[model samples]
Target: MSALGVVGGVLQPLLVAAGAPLLVGVMRQVRARLEGRAGPGVGQPWRDLRKLLRKEAITPRGTSEVFRLAPLVLVATTLVVAVVVPFVTTDSALDPVADLFAVVALLALGTVAVALAGLDTGTAFGGMGASREMTIIALVEPTLLVAIFALSVRVGSTNLASIVASTLHDPARVISPVSLLAAVALIVVIVAETGRLPVDNPATHLELTMVHEAMVLEYAGPDLALVELASAMRLTVFLGLLANLFLPWGIATTATALAVLGGVLAFALKVTLLGAVLAVGEVFLAKLRLFRVPELLAGSFLLALLAVAASFFLA
Candidate 1:
């Protein structure tokens, strides 16, 4: 790879890691405005990160080392996953190994680690959250894989870069009903996976209703910051995948400077529009009861399976 390529690879994660929190801030701002409340500044997340970093970490008396380490693992896994995803460009250094299945596996690994750590804390809330989280994952992952398989069938490859390349090579594929179904299924998966509205509420602290938040209730200081950052990055990564894989309009297939810049702008625009849609969705919907989450995910799974069948018959 050229020096610019190497540099671009290194910068991708940094940009995503930083941009993730900013995206959260923006979403919050939008939500606040819709709710007629003045939101915290867009830089609020950065301030929170800095404050968390400076505070001393406190572990519960009975907590194991795994609890202490989970935050670091969460951040590291998110960073690694972000690098593997085709964000600004398809020429990721890690693209060769970026199989869609492997990406799903990595995400599952991170989820399991966090859930285990949550249960390790011996808190009722943490354990409850972990249970809910695993249940959601069980319902969501299959649908995610099925959606990806739908795309894989069209592109004839499971590698994400290849999928993007195939779609770019034939833009008309996006308008197919199979593509539309897959996109819809993936969007639902994204909402469920990212702890957004109608599935889980990211803004709530209620123990009974909070799945992701309950799991991290025991985390404090730098550990909490890392987990929070990881959550944001995870959201960004999934949305980025949805944008680039389906759209792929301006994503760079080669390591050219102008192409990279165009890819960056296109990426920002896509994610911003997605974030706005998410905000509006949250505004219009209430969080589902824990029991109802499974039904929602099941519908997504069926849509994804239908998408696959459609691709087979139509493509």
Candidate 2:
């Protein structure tokens, strides 16, 4: 790999690891401020992670090794994605793993790990949450695949780096119907996959409505910290993908230190803006009923399908 590629490979994961929590904190603070409350600073999530790490790790009774390993698996997969995705530079550290299919599978693996862990716990809420998560994933993964495929069809490659490079080369595609429809489709999957508002509220404690939270109820201390951190990182990965896929102007094309630095700054700025917008929008929206979520997801799927069709016909 080139110097810039190596630098990006190292820097991307570090930024995602360190910045994910701050992103969550920023979103929470934005929502709080919009609602006229004095919110905790952006460092609050980091503080919480630190505190959780210092606490005693707990394993619930009768739970198997799945419970113990899920957190690590979740984090491990996300970290790999942070490395492979073209967040900082187009040069992938592992080109073989930088395909759109591989990235989506890695993400799905993390989700499945947590769901299986929840099922292992043998609790009513755990099973409910696991089932609900699987339901969402069923709709989510296909839409994510089809939407990205829409972009790839025009580029003639499924490799994410190639797609990003193509977008950078043909800036006009950004305003095309295929791109716009894919963008809308991607935005919905991002919100759903990340457990954001109008799909699954990340902050809610009520069991009736819990999706992500319900699955992790048995976790405590450091394990819980890992889960939360992985969750944040997943959001960061998705948002970063969305930003770079659609508005890839500021991403570094040349292999230079200054260019890489610019890419980092651009990435952070884009993701923060997206997170803030999502948070502000959430303030004015309520979580959709569980039964209503499929309708929303199906609508997104249709958009993705349309995008794919448009890409082929318009091209």
Candidate 3:
């Protein structure tokens, strides 16, 4: 890591922590407005976090250490990702420490922590949610890896920052069919991974229907706050990665102060716009039945596979 990279790594978490709540709140507010209701404003997520923090955490009787540890692990893993991935600038200090494969592994670790915690509680609902989440992850992970493989194959590196820098240096890469197909597969993964519409509805409380909510239904107070914050950060990190990877034009390549500032502004705008697009997309799309989700993801997987084939065959 260059000296500037160290500074960037330090600042990345603070930026992510500050912006995640606002992004989540914006998506919620926008979606609500689309649904014809006066939704909670963009400040709502921050308020919700504050309200949860002030309350006491109450763990249930049948839980163990895993239950208590999972929330912290979840937040910690996501914080590492926020620090390593090129959020605002392509000059990533932690680049070698966690490449694209490492990023996926860290996220998987967080998922495992939560899933184990869910199972540890032994609640029927928790088990059901964990089972469903694991199933989805199993199906989606290959597509995620395949999509990355396609991008990396095009750029000749698995490092995300390198890929972005390479793609920016070669404008023709943006128009490649491999890039488009990979992006389509990735967008679908983002929808599924973030528990958004047409997959698992984040806002729903239907006992038999909600996948993400059911796992954390037993959490309250500070623990719940941590889980919620980590979830928001996860979505933010994903969107930031998507923005930076596909639209690398405005990202800062150097550590100059003014350049960094521009990169930050550009990244924020890109991610916020992505969030708005997803929120609006959700307004028109209905959530699919649980069984149907696999079919949708199966299509995504095929697209990703084709993306990989195109990169190797067409190139």
lDDT winner between 1 and 3, please give it: 3
Model 1, residue 257: distance off in Å is: 1.8
lDDT tens digits, residue span 78-141, model 1:
7877777777777656766578888888888888889999899998998999999999999888
Candidate 1 structure, TM-score to reference: 0.96
Of 2 and 3, the candidate ranking higher by lDDT: 2
Q: How many clashes does each candidate structure show, in the order listed?
A: 0, 0, 0
Q: Per-residue CA lDDT of candidate 2, range 250-305, in tens? A: 88878877898899999999999999999998999999999999999999999999
Model 1 residue pairs with clashes: none
Candidate 2 achieves a global lDDT of: 0.95
lDDT of each: 0.85, 0.95, 0.88
Query: What C-alpha lDDT does candidate 1 achieve relative to the native structure?
Result: 0.85
Off by over 4 Å in 1: 1-8
For model 2, which pairs clash? none
Arranged by lDDT with the best first, the candidates are 2, 3, 1
| Candidates ranked, most accurate by TM-score first | 2, 3, 1
**Model 3: per-residue Cα lDDT over 237-288, one tens digit each:** 9898888778887777778888788878887899899999999999999989
